[model samples]
Target: RSAGVSKAHDPRHAAKMFKSAQEDKTGRWLAIHFTSHDNPHISRDALEELIQDMSKQSYRQEILAEDDEIQLSWLVYRAFNERTNKIDDFEIPKNWLVYVGHDFGGANPAALFVAQDPATGNFYEFKEYLPGAGHSTAQHVDMFKELTTGYSVIWRSGGSHQEGEIRQGYSSHGWPIVEPKINSVKAQVDKVVGTMELNKVFIFKSLHNRLTEVMNCLWAPDAEGIPTDKIKDEEKYHLSACARYLYCNFTPDTVVHNKSRTSHSMSM
Candidate 1:
């Protein structure tokens, strides 16, 4: 710990400290590693202000623009390679893990590996994977086997054929397959939104491709900013659809009501 370095506990406090540091002529550099969440929404001015404040208050160091980018394969390797930390443990009370995927057929199939902690109501991670990575059905089977060894998975499809393929290929291997609950565009969007409200839906840190696909899917130029029918990115629509399916299946209210009425009728 450097001198005059006190931990700023809150975001506002951290921002104030940055300002304090920038004012210090002795500060020549500012090296910051953000372990906290980064939102793309923060304004440039706000970011600049924080940076400038830190530089001015403390002995500013070089402002380095470096980000640690981890991939899904790497994350999986890491997660399974060693005992997961309490922070990353999939078994944590608040945590729920699932996979949402789409197939482009012959092209790299897209997927989002999602995990949410119901206890904390925070998303652990939503990541993307290539279903076609292994080449043959055996390869896909292996990938699916590895991908879904221990978590609940939600799969989304444009149709049922792929589901059949998955069932035949992987279900026998004991890969848990939840039926893909198909929904229209508005319904799908609503499902995603509703899930987010009910529980924290965090995209896995490693799955940038899947995250990007879902975000892109939401960006169509119709319905005046409302998400429209035209799914510009088929991959995105498919993955997001999977996400909606997960929400629809698990959330209590969304779960289909058991219509078979049970009567405690005493037969005469």
Candidate 2:
């Protein structure tokens, strides 16, 4: 007898059946539980593509054989490092350019504090804030002001849904702001992939909220089980949107000045 367990079947029931079969030692019995990651026939390139395209839940259940409530898998965890990238909190160098990326949704407004290393051109996301629901724009601005008191911050806004209102709110409080022309979603995602591949992005170890978003954001799947460019789990992607805006819009030449701290804007 042989048994296999998949997302289509109950793992608990499969375990019970396998245990019962094991007790009946009169006949040869084999039980196998496997996911896509378990298959020896898959090529390395194919596996990487599959992982890049699959949703988190799909990857966990179909590739790792683990049942995760979130159907989509994260797109970034494979590249992020807690030791090298995710470092301990430290004072950002005075010469480093600092910027804030904002995803402006009234229900769950998200912001990320990013700093660029002048010498290496690498970017570090050091802090994140997600104030959920019922918070006014003034309140959000106040919070940001408190966090970025001394730094000269160049604010980048994502999503045109409430762009005008958000800009006004920040501008009223004397926050310097700009809206970079939005690129195609695929282009933004590709930029992130390229940065990660080159090991140019980093995060502070204490920014758990942003890390969680990075680990949970997933691509939506079509009826034929193909991953689409559309992202699933909108509620969990606020911080990701902020990161994408900064990644797609801000570059070393554009945002970082040699020593004068001059600011420039460019669109990806």
Candidate 3:
């Protein structure tokens, strides 16, 4: 869709323009409106008209009513907006129990660091490591160690897609990584969804790479274009796999108030 050419559309030109937005995202001039039919500003007639028009294009994105112009066919994390919070200048107290979840990638390895608040039983993803390509396992271990220097990293684990050598590489280097206790993909997705619904998970805003993966985490589609349980673009969603590794490994027990625990709330 062009500025004034609704009937005559040029997709190639439109794609080129959109690609520019992706390249330099900081300064873009796109008038984005995120109002749904339930918006209070809409009159009854306007709402009815919007609904009627939406019914015609139910599966496609209603660009005028949403900010995400490209609607994900099957979004993986539905509770990402409501349950997750992002803060610019938040600090993790030294007392919080920290854990790292990792994914050994084909091109590059990635890790996500999460801290558990003993008092509220909430999990916060404070930092991430997703340096793309050419870095060795030893370097990744060193970077992770350096990142969580002061925090008490109780455990670190990941899924190497049954490639024992990759996990072995980390273990031999002294990181001592382990396989996830909850190994099933269904189990991992279920656990993440369950925890998110309970308001126990919050991902920091600083993790740009991780956040980008989360937004693009979509279920793979079948031959008939119906979304299936298998994830689409698995390579691009490596950090998302790290997220699945995270909640599966760190199952928070009932919040037993620790009097000595620092009051550094996971409140964004």
Q: Write the per-residue lDDT of candidate 3 for residues 1-268, one digit (tens) a residue.
A: 5686543222123534555666765675553335454467768786667666453334234424322433433667766652236555389989898878888875877888988887777778888887889887878878888999988887777885586678888899988777776778767877677667667778887887777666667777666445689877776777777878767654434333553222322321
Q: Which model scores highest in lDDT?
A: 3
| Candidate 2 RMSD computed on C-alpha atoms after optimal superposition onto the true structure | 11.0
| lDDT by residue (tens digit), candidate 1, 1-268 | 5899754422133444555675667767574554212545767676666665553212122233221121121121112211122122234232253444444345555444555443343444444556544376556557755766666553433324345666455456644354445445555555555545443354443554444443334233343323344555544445555555444444423322232111112111
What TM-score does model 1 achieve against the real structure?
0.46
lDDT on C-alpha atoms for all candidate structures: 0.43, 0.66, 0.68
**How much is 206 displaced in model 3, in angstroms?**
0.9
lDDT of 1: 0.43
Candidate 2, residues 181-213, lDDT tens digits: the string is: 555666666656666666778888788877766
For each candidate, how many residue pairs have backbone atoms clashing (under 3 Å)? Answer: 35, 6, 0
**Model 2 spans with C-alpha error above 4 angstroms:** 1-83, 251-268
